[model samples]
Target: MTLNPNLRLRRAARIIVLDPEGRALMFRYDVPGRPPFWVTAGGECEPGESFDAAARRELLEETGIIADPGEEIARLTPEFITVEGEPVQADERFYLVRVSEARIDTSRHTALEQRLMTQHRWFTRAELADWPEAVFPESIVTMIEQQERAR
Candidate 1:
């Protein structure tokens, strides 16, 4: 699909938050009248913000977590339509973080997220591989495997 000429390129920072048991946290977005999908917790970097800084801020904003974002693990650029009907070419950098639990506080979600996000869950790699619903970063299983091998 052609990107919207009116929108600028988007640089997003995403966090792959895992628990001690290695299950990854994902946000379940269920837009009104639309099918649901799981996504990582993060957003586009604002002006004057570094990718790492934006990742940290978004992680807290989306999940109320305040852990170090650590290092960038993978980068992918994908083109997709936004919830607002805008076509976005997103340059996304994914960071890996291990959290203690899967619980999240949604009070910090922005107006947009608050409207779209329905729930959150921690998925084991095997579960993710077998998930019947759609998940962003389609190669999540491979990414987790790489992170595991590195540890």
Candidate 2:
């Protein structure tokens, strides 16, 4: 699909949060009348915000998990339409972060998040492999596998 040039590119940062057990934490978005999907916790960077800073901020804002976001592990530019019906060209960087717990505090979610995001779950690599819902990157399984192989 051709992306609308009227929409400027958005710089975003995402955290691949792994719990102590190595399960990845993801947020489930359920928009009524549309198919549900899962996405990592993160969002667009604020003005003048560095990618690392944005990653850390988004992680806490979206999941209420305050933890150090490690180095960037992957990057991608994906074009898609937003929930608001606006086309988005996102330059997203994924960072690896480890958390001690999977429990999330949703008090910090933005209005949009509170409305669209329904749940959060910790999934093992095996679980992710068989996940029925749509995944954002669509390459999440391969990314995890590559990370595992690198280590």
| Cα-based TM-score, every candidate | 0.91, 0.89
RMSD of each: 2.5, 2.3
Q: Give lDDT per model, in order.
A: 0.87, 0.84
Tens digits of per-residue lDDT for model 2 on 1-151?
Answer: 3444777888999888888898988889988777999988898899999999999999889888887888888998888777777678888899888777767788999899899998888988888878898877777777777777888
Instruction: Give one digit per residue, the lDDT tens place, for model 1 in 1-151.
Output: 3444566689899999998899999988887666788998899999989999999999999988998899999998788777777788888899998888777888998888888887888999998988998899898889989989998
Against the hidden true structure, what lDDT does model 2 obtain?
0.84
Query: Between which residue pairs do clashes occur in model 2?
Result: none
The numbered model that scores best in lDDT is 1
